[model samples]
Target: MTQVALTISAEADLIRVRQVLRARCQRVGLGLVDETKLITAGSELARNILTHAVGSRGGVRVEDVARSGRQGVKATFFDEGPGIPDVDQALVDGFSTSGSQGIGLPGSKRLVDEMTITTEVGSGTVVEIVKWRRDRSWRP
Candidate 1:
């Protein structure tokens, strides 16, 4: 496994986080479409870390993983800000507290293979997502 951490505290940090995720995904041999999906998901999540998790304090842990002969990229994010009060609503598409079309969490979920999130209303939030490598013969 290869891991890197990129801060998600500012708009500029979004670029860094996306860069790290893109690189990690490429290193894991993700295809063009997969790379786009991963970067898009990472962008949405990193943006949320800045917007929702007020004060824009948080970071994303990016990694290239190999387990049981399957390889993938994983992104784990954490923020010490007022967390989502309703995780369910947060996961629902078209739900947004900030009111900007509300597609981040749900959209990201569709782009990745697995996702898990934990949050506390007054404490913080954590989200982890993974996209596994696809078989070369059938990938497009």
Candidate 2:
């Protein structure tokens, strides 16, 4: 298992996150489509950290994982900013506290195989997402 952690303190870090995620996804043997999905999701989350968590500590950890002979990539985004007051509402398609398109969280979830968010009103938030490589041998 390989792991890399990067801090998201500026706009440039978002690009770095995408680059690292893309490399890790390719190393895990994920195809172009899956890699794109994961990188998009990671970019959204990393941007969130920069946009919403400014002046606070935020970052993402990307790791290569394997389970049941399946290869996958996992990313965990964390921040020490004001946490989401309403997680359910935040997950809604059109809910936005910052007045943007409000698709970051929900859209990101759709791009990954699994996603989970843990947050507190005052403490902070942690979002973990995983995308598993498609098994080429499977047939309908």
Candidate 3:
């Protein structure tokens, strides 16, 4: 169940993307706190796509997934920029290429149930995350 898919090309786009993620998550039974986490995580990833990717060229896709009897929301942020030179270092807290607090990557990870990163130095990056609904599990 792909709930939201859209292009994020600027700061303005980021706001809309986060709003959609929040609304979709809430509509799908995610509690307020869970919705905030999802939106926050999505915001960080989406911001990275804009800040690091070329021309802020990227897109976001959020979907509803029920796997292994667990229900969750999945969000993927992809960009065709100069890929992350060091995925490991980037994931480390306090590491920022753009010179900020550097909590975006690691903090986003903490907000989600699972996260995976795929990137190539000269190519691009794709970050996917999932947040499960612990109060209820999906059967079938």
Candidate 4:
């Protein structure tokens, strides 16, 4: 089940995107902590898109995925910016090409159950993040 899909052109639109994601996650019975993590991860990725790919547009997609007969929330952020040249270095903590705190990739990886990055120089970047439903708890 896909819940939220949004595109942001302005940096200010990123906040609204995050809010929509958080609300959609909560409505689906994802834990509060999980919702926060999703929003934070989305914010970081969206911010990167805005700062690096300004004047371009990007979006976040929220989906419900089934695994081992269970379901979970899956979120993806995509941008059509100058793709990362070095994916290995890009994943390292504090290794930003930009003069900013470099926790976007690694930090987002830690927040989600799984993450995957795909990019091509002069093309774009796509980051997919997933958080599986934990059987130990059910919000609904």
Candidate 5:
């Protein structure tokens, strides 16, 4: 697996995240659908990082994984925020403590092949998502 990691801060980083993901998708020859999904998912996670993290910054890491003649991208977000008090409730559709769009987490998960999150009550959060290339034989 190959990994790309970065610290996320300011609104500009939001756009940067999408750009980086799109570039990686292109580098790995991912299709438009896959690229779009990565962009959307990246945006959502970045939004959450900005909104909830407050004074702290977050990190986003993207990795390339190969298996079974297929390639997948894994994106992970780490934040030093107040963290989710209730993971189950936060993941449920239409349930948001911040009360914004409430679609960031759930929507992001729907766009990826796998999604996992972990958080501490007073520490921070880590969200990881993976998207597999559409073509099984695809490679960079």
Candidate 6:
């Protein structure tokens, strides 16, 4: 497994995060559409780190992963900020604590194959997302 880690300290870091994810997605044999989806989702999460976790320890880790003979890419966004109070409410499309469009979390979830959020009220939040390549030879 190959991994890349980067700090989310400024707006510039968001760009870097996207670039890293794009590269990893390609490395994992993801198609252009898959790459776009993963990169878009990554950008949203990186932005969340900057917008919601200002002055906190925030970072992103992207890596290549495989499961059941399938190749995929995974990105994990973490921050030591005021954790989410209500995860279900936060996932709602129109929900926002900072007066934004409130689509980051939900939109990202739709873009990835799997997404998981681990958060505590006062501790922090960690969101992990994965996108698997569609195998042409596999059928369910």
TM-score against truth, every candidate? 0.92, 0.94, 0.92, 0.89, 0.93, 0.95
Distance from true location, Cα of 19 in model 5, Å = 0.8
- Evaluate model 5: give its lDDT: 0.85
Q: Give the TM-score of candidate 6.
A: 0.95
Give the number of the best model, judged by TM-score.
6
lDDT of each: 0.85, 0.91, 0.85, 0.80, 0.85, 0.91
Query: CA shift at 37, candidate 4, in angstroms?
Result: 1.2
For all candidates, the clash counts are 0, 0, 0, 0, 0, 0
What candidate 6 gets wrong by more than 4 Å, as runs, is 136-140
Error of 6 at 117 (Å): 0.1
lDDT for each residue of candidate 2 in 24-98, tens digit (9 for 90 to 100): 888878889999999999999999988888799999999987778787899999999899999989999988989
lDDT per residue, candidate 5, 1-140, as tens digits? 36888778888888888887887788777889988998899889988999999899798998776777878777899999999998888877888778686887888889988899999978999999888888876545
lDDT of 1: 0.85
Full-model lDDT, candidate 4: 0.80
Q: In candidate 1, which residue pairs get closer than 3 Å at backbone N, Cα or C atoms, i.e. clash?
A: none
Off by over 4 Å in 1: 136-140
In the range 53-109, model 1's lDDT, one tens digit per residue, is: 878469999887766677888999999989999999988989989978988999999
Clashing pairs in 2: none
Residue 51 lDDT in candidate 4 = 77
